[model samples]
Target: MKRILLVVLLGLISHFNFAQNPTGDWYGNLEVQPGVILPLVFHISEAEGIYSGTLDSPDQKAFDIPITNVTYTDTNLSIAITDMRLTYEGVVRSNALIEGTFKQSGLTIPLQLTREAVAIEAPNRPQEPQAPFPYTVQEITFDNKEANATFSGTITLPKVVFKGKKKLPAVILISGSGPQDRNEELLGHKPFLVIADYLTRNGIAVLRYDDRGTAASTGEFTGATSADFATDAQAAFDFLKTHPDIDASKIGFAGHSEGGLIAPMVAATNKEVAFIALLAGVGQPGDELLMDQGYLIGKAQGFDDEMLRKNRIAQEMMFTTVKEHYGDTEKIKEKLTIYLENALEQNPEMIPEGSSKEAMIKREINTLTSDWFQYLIITDPRPTLEKVTCPVLAINGSLDLQVPSQKNLTNIEESVKKGGNTDVTTVEFPNLNHLFQTTTTGSPSEYAILEETFSPDALKVLSEWIIEKTK
Candidate 1:
């Protein structure tokens, strides 16, 4: 998210005798992207003349994260969250103002802290179901014995019972890559919750749960990869099959983004899956897909052709190094360091101001060689999609930049068809973004600003297809 720092026009300077101490709530907005804004607040308290505090990322749902170290002397204020690898350095420009730079990983963005609490209005989501919903919503828990993970989530069933007649068809919702909650909440929009409500209203049962180590789920998420998450989805499917009201033969999955990649992963090996709906799923190899993503997003952000080319080259170097040295982390790190060093030598600007070359290389190595990235870059989705014989509905928006609709959707359809399974449908909706929200440009900058969580047309397509498939 991109945020602009609000300038405090009050030109009042405080006397040295009555300086404003770095104590109390200091609020600021971080423009993470070109147009996206993430608001952060630091609550500093002084005890025995020593500084300590907590941090809040309001939009990201991370609250009260302890600030490991706080150093304030004269007009300088520095805060560090060692666990999160975040740091902030600021100058107390005025009694009520602190001009600072928020640094995390390797990215740095300007932040203007103010004494007054800034009000951030939540995006209006008319589609978010109000209470008195038309279905039965139950807070539930299921266990993944393989991961030794216990997941907490919600299951919404239609009000009508089908005891002795036909059992209700159900779908398990799988979220994209991240620490997603049951609702797969992002940018104030809960697409899974909205989808669950809609499907349940139309007589299909829906189960959605938090990811491992997120919300109520118990497991270590940091080191887990997509292969590990598939077990969790399998657990949800197994749990639903055991439910008296759910049709064991009709259970399926609806996954978005990375979740889209995961749906096929489970279905490919599990014949019990009746069908799967891939929401902007990954069909190409992870490296190629990510390269395309970077190019498209860069173009949307108005990056020059030269810059885009340079970025793509850098990405290729990183991806190739990782793919070539998939299992050997040490080799991967060594090669990545060399590549980064060479790139930095060619362009000193590669290293951000105030950050050392060593620090930049380390951050790059850690991120590029992560368990998830390593698996993703080297792993191909075509083989997985080809193995999925179950009925499939792969859909994406024409304007989706993250996963370019044409290339991915085409690859998905072709791969599935090559497996000699004709029971597949793929649709590319116009004017919709990766989240399927109708937008002028598919840039992520528009996700928070757009009111529509999931398009009515898209929702209807998903619900109707699942109903028809179950019947």
Candidate 2:
């Protein structure tokens, strides 16, 4: 995700016009990589004496993404997108130019803006559906009674049902981590939306919703752990089963990434679920998975195996120390600090440049104490998989660096089979990333630039698997 910006050229400039407000389309291009340039447009406007704006990343196919806040003085501009962890700072140098730096993910790159006459065209996603009359999309709210939260979402069903059909098979989509909206929108791709559209068009019912405290959902999002998220899936499962047009026994879970880990958690206890689809799910203990995830992604970014090994070892020790002193934050902090200090003393190079050993230790402590990471760091997904007696379909892409295809799929398959689950199928699609997008390299930086949002081939395989198993 390294985006080092270098100016290739500049747009035409115009005469000064200071009295005019900066309420117009300001455009800039971000060189995300060496060859890929992502164009960004900020539509700044004022309403009720407050500044507001929407951002467009044309190359990423993301248009009109809401900017949380945009405040500017007569000569300076400040814009922010809290959810995306992005911020922009600029000063109006002239009528045609606004000099700025785009900050995201700890990188600063020059992103001076130029007034654009024509709008920056967002890339077309041919597969994204245009409304007409194909499926029945119903607004919904399911009660997560266990957690005292209400989830808002949409349920898409095929408009045409067979004459003799008593109940329609259904699938509930669980998002990966973080607070995601119903569409699981990220990196300019709405994978869940594409999946729901394709599945409903093919006669499958799909339920997808916002995470707790996200969008229209109600609850505290950041304070919840993966275990708490499992209950959210269970709640959705219960609600889907109650639908008059749904076959209670045929309702299943289709979880992606961290969501995949949540699927077995729901299925293990909810016997009503008929099947499950695991997309790039965790197949090992969370600590090991984290290590592998970082290592693979680092290697993809040009890190040598020796460097990765050193970092891996260092992290392993920290994770081990944290786990050993579980539930005791004070001891965990003390031990982790000592562990980090020793590691640094042995090799000062281990500490990141411009950062101290103490700061890194504090950051590690905070991470290990978080509700989400603490639970998942040592979690073993197999234990839950063993309890899920329903039919299972686990699939991963060969090029997925986050969840390496071989070990994850193989271990998941083995764990389920050992639990006497003969109704299981596992597959790894060639050359696709964790998001199921076709790419040259599985680096996540390419996700935004790649035109293919979700591979039709992979979606077809998954949709077919779900339909078959549910039937």
List runs of model 2 lying over 4 Å from the truth.
Answer: 1-30, 34-108, 113-120, 342-359
Quality of model 1 by C-alpha lDDT: 0.88
Question: Can you give the lDDT of residue 192 in candidate 1?
Answer: 92
Query: Candidate 2's residue-wise lDDT over 43-150, tens digit each?
Result: 999988799989987544467898878888767899977656578989888767888888875567888788973344565566667788488989999898888899
Which stretches of candidate 1 lie above 4 Å from their native place? 1-19, 23-25, 29-37, 43-55, 62-73, 78-117, 161-165
What's the C-alpha lDDT at position 45 in model 1?
Answer: 95
Model 2 residue 231 CA deviation in Å: 0.6
**Candidate no. 2 TM-score:** 0.80
**Highest lDDT among the candidates is held by which one?**
1
Overall lDDT per candidate, in order of appearance: 0.88, 0.83
Candidate 1's residue-wise lDDT over 1-471, tens digit each?
123222222222335425677799999978777556788888999999899999988678788988878998878999876545678999987768999888875678899999987776655899999999878888889999888899999999898754454679999999988899998889889999899998898889999999999999998888788999998999999899998878899999999999999999999999999999999999999999999999999899887898889989999989998988898999998888888988988877656554566767877788888898898898789999999999999999999999999999999999999998899999999999999999999998889878899998899999999988988
Clashing pairs in 2: none
Best-fitting candidate, scored by TM-score: 1
